[model samples]
Target: MNAPRTLRAALVYFNDFENCQRFMIDLRWPDGVVRCPTCGSDKVTYLADDKRWKCYAKHPRAKFSLKVGTVLEDSPIGLEKWLPAM
Candidate 1:
């Protein structure tokens, strides 16, 4: 019944996870520490195809994306749409 509420919900639903991830990464690791999100270890490797980082330290979630351990978990959006939204 409320147009504004519906629009707000739609926007939230359309949030871009990749862009959110990159943004969060820049915010958290501006100097490009490339640390493991799960274990806080600087030992990490980038997986370009999957866009994720792998940690040398063994953990439940050794591999993680830029959005891992952030507010954008489980989102299915892209950076192209997310930058404008922000």
Candidate 2:
């Protein structure tokens, strides 16, 4: 077995923006299905370029990020700093 990684090392792991986004996506939707939190619509598309999810439903706000509806929604801090604290 290998020795456990230190806190500093683990933090470095999350420092990568892409990894942080993937981690948050998994944490939020374990089944890997991205849905619209607003209309509860499963018909959503992954906007990779913008790093946000867009709901196909006819709504004023069709686009949203993983941060939507969560406590960290308005926080400037990313999942890189938030997940470690969990």
Candidate 3:
């Protein structure tokens, strides 16, 4: 989905977890392929329960969330709140 045009719209649009996730995914991986940020590998799977991605290839940091490798990394803030502020 397109980004909200106004500040109020963004606040409403990004309130939902699913909408925030999809917005971040699209913003991060515009091509629709999620990859391992550390290894640059595309062989990854999303763990719905965990709300993160796991790289199948053996690696030290196989599991990653949307915040990994980003300014949001290590922050406790949720995307539902962060995305709208961007």
Candidate 4:
């Protein structure tokens, strides 16, 4: 998102749940192509209900979230706080 006109506006934007989720989603899939981090497969399906992406490849660890493979992995804190604090 473009820089807000004020710091308060930035805070308001980051506090929004949907906006934060969108930001994380975009950050995870910067190229607009969602791939499985485990198996390196592009045929992944977004399971919004589960808040994670599932790979089409047959594997036990076929699901991953934005936190996976990053420093934020397994973080219980939501992105609304974690991302902004980063």
Task: Compare the candidates by TM-score and give the number of the best one.
Answer: 3
Q: Which parts of model 1 are misplaced by more than 4 Å?
A: 1-24
Q: Lowest-lDDT window of 10 residues in candidate 3? A: 75-84
lDDT of 2 at 72: 88
Q: How does each model score on TM-score? A: 0.65, 0.78, 0.92, 0.75
The full ranking of all candidates by TM-score, starting with the best, is: 3, 2, 4, 1
On lDDT, the leading prediction is: 3
Candidate 1 structure quality by residue, lDDT tens digits, 1-86: 12114445535544655444555566679885878877789989888788788998988888987767666666786544544455
Worst 10 residues of 4 by lDDT: 1-10
Tell how far residue 1 is off in model 3, in angstroms. Answer: 4.5
Kindly report which residue pairs in candidate 1 clash with one another. Answer: none
Give residue 46's lDDT in candidate 2 (0 to 100): 85
- Give the alpha-carbon lDDT of every model: 0.66, 0.79, 0.88, 0.76
Q: What shift in Å separates residue 47 of candidate 2 from its native position after superposition?
A: 1.7
Residue-by-residue lDDT tens digits, candidate 3, 16-77: 88898888789789997888998989999999999989999998999998899899997788
Q: Write the per-residue lDDT of candidate 4 for residues 1-86, one digit (tens) a residue.
A: 45345566756887986677677667777776867889889999889899888999999889988678877887888766776665
Q: Candidate 2, which segments miss by more than 4 Å at Cα?
A: 1-6
Candidate 3 regions with alpha-carbon error over 4 angstroms: none
